[model samples]
Target: MNQFNRQHIGKRIAALRAAHGDSLRQAAARTGVSHTTVGRLEAGQFGTSLNSTLRKIAEGYGVTVEYLLTGRDPQHDFESSLRRLPPEERNRLYFASPVTRIRMLLQFLMAEYPAEFPLDRLAARLGMSPESLRRLVEGCDDRQFTPEEVRRLGEQLAKVTSIPLHWFLSGDSGELAAAIPPEMLGAYVRLIKKAAEAGVRPDLLEMAIDLLILKHREMPAGSQNGRRGG
Candidate 1:
């Protein structure tokens, strides 16, 4: 890629990393790479060795190297490769890959919906036994999900929770207005619930307001109440 394109890619990488709540240090810890290297990679300050850098990032983000490199669909090819391995070995590599985040989220959802969508039912959907699904969810920190599998899992999760698939796949939480902070989350939940009762989508305008509140919280104490010119 040209320098401009590379820089834009770096920015995208940074945005994704930030959105995932990861820091250069966390990525370094996971990838056995240095923090400085990650910082440089995210800034497009390094050239060449781009392939290796992209590989590390793809693995870290549970994306395909091809996706990182060319923004092409790499899910099918990666998933096909994953399925060819022996079951146990595949399990090991899958858990160790970067897409393990999806596994963690699945586990979180299972816990969050224990009564309504129990483990057995979820396993059936994934074409796995309860024990296997349990293992998959429990060991997600060590597992890597290919992008296709992640997309499939996101779709399944949407079906189970009555949420939209794009929300999960694209990492947009429509309920952020009411689902972010635990403190005032109940208030927003009630608002959304009221909207549901009224048969209207809770206006995302409320969510935009909530985001501004969150942004204010992120500011320094001195800046918190200070008005700034646009």
Candidate 2:
């Protein structure tokens, strides 16, 4: 709507939900997001949300998420798409449609390796075909999976990336601390929390820290001691 903002987008989501005759709790139940989060999205209080969350919201609102985000159907005008919308959201221009962050770690990791990558193993773990898994990580956003399925997806992705489950679930970077060995977890979390508070993109910060760790591990012992002392 006005100025492509989060607040306006939130207003749209609220309007669409109300027009659909679904209360916050009902929408949350149908969408698999918590009611509190649904309220936050309606209030424009959310930041870059996860794509899985958006898919659930799209299902709750009865529109393909692409049409919802850009106000135009993939195949036709916005009006034509509304012919497919659940009657209530037609021309309700105020639905919150902020751009969401598809889980980036999955894409990054998927590309980092050679072609011999173990897609089948990951797919078997998630109970999906490799094709379906590729489409999902590539941001097809075509379906609203159940919360349990989403959790399993997160768990599997977390294992592959060695990141925390919360990162996969919510896009929160603080979860990077969980990847640390238990002996260092408390200190790492606290330090990373401070870095996160500085308004850096926490994911990028995590990558930089990861590279530093690898470099540290590979350094000669004398140089490592010298650098540490310096």
Candidate 3:
């Protein structure tokens, strides 16, 4: 790409990183690139031949390579506007329980394109019977979706709604976790669960939990969070 295009891609990368709540180091780790490389990419200072690196970054962010290079994905404009919302509001919408967010997204698609997305037609498009789709949306016990079923739904949702497939499967939590080192994410989730069990106020603990994860990540592998090796 030319310098102008390179800079534009860099800006898109930065935006994607921010929207996913990832720092440069975290993004680098996730993409298997060095932290300095990620910093350089965000600053538009990459060498010629960035195609491989760009693909890796795009994969890390659960975005298409075209979206990263051209910012022209179907969801690009909508996701950009979402990123501009106050963090609290964005978090509330994105971090809602998976079922709730999926329902909200369905409602949004239905309302936004009522003529195009009537229930039976939408169900047919999803390769499901209308009653099955209804049960899925209504969370009926008889129609509970298996993980594979959810994955299939996510793929169809991505096609129809222009939302990322992960949004349908894991909501915002999956996006955030994708930005973190995979090895660390499990520990972070455990910590969050423990904090909740201990009666820590979730809103207040949010920042603390993130800080703790960052700190723990810096420790040598196999070391505990705070304890030093003998």
Candidate 4:
């Protein structure tokens, strides 16, 4: 029995197939299902438990299994909330595009201690050429990322920089700062206090300015935000 509603799944699969210009035969070949079975599936006549086959269809179309099944944008409904925000708030959220966020963290790290973080060593460790790393950083400039990519990159960068992931993905930085753990909040507060005592203003206005340069390439309303991985 199909635990998931079959009609919606079939409709979604059919839509994706059509969008990709794939015939039923083509999808059947890719998924190893018979052409008739593919056609039936597209018509909501049957369902399957073959996750690998489902994944093949999803990957071929660059969508997540959840999106494929429900015809919804990925991100657990956060993408929907994005549309409800005002234009400036939406712009601020988009400003922290994955690439831009990662580059900002990297630039801050390197500038704070050039000798401690060797660019060559870091590049080699990541198996990326220095030029490639440079390009990756520069790519943030005037660039945009899909929501899936943004979420993935935000998680990865958060792990690397020890920053809370929410800080990067949160629709608002002010609200995100308030949500940090108490211990983490104490650390930041203390750091700010120390900086003030030392006559060093720990202003991150420049970082915000850099983030502002990111061009928002958000998907249109009602468009699916695709996903990667299982």
User: What are the per-model C-alpha RMSD values against the true structure?
Assistant: 20.1, 20.1, 16.4, 19.4
lDDT of 3 by residue, 32-86 (tens): 7777888888898986658788878876777766576666653564566568877
Regions more than 4 Å wrong, model 1 = 1-4, 76-230
lDDT of 4 by residue, 148-213 (tens): 766766665443334567656643334434343322344444554565577773356434323422
Report the C-alpha lDDT of model 1 over 1-230, residue by residue, as the tens digit: 45236676677677767888888888787666578887887777775777677667766666644344444432443345457867544433321332353464466546544543478877886666787678777663332455777677767654443344554454232344333444444444455557657777445645654675677568785663354421
Better of 2 and 3 by TM-score: 3
The CA lDDT of each predicted structure is 0.57, 0.56, 0.68, 0.56
TM-scores of the candidates are: 0.31, 0.32, 0.39, 0.37
The lDDT leader among the candidates is 3
Relative to the unseen true structure, what is the Cα RMSD of model 3? 16.4
Predicted structure 3, TM vs. truth: 0.39
Q: Model 3: residues >4 Å from true position, as ranges?
A: 1-89, 139-143, 172-230
Per-residue lDDT tens digits of candidate 2, residues 48-98? Answer: 664567667866666544434444332233224336765333222111111
Better of 2 and 3 by lDDT: 3
Q: Which run of 10 residues does model 4 get worst, by summed lDDT?
A: 221-230
Backbone clashes in candidate 3 total: 0
Task: Candidate 1: give the clashing pairs.
Answer: 94-143, 94-144, 95-142, 95-143, 95-144, 96-142
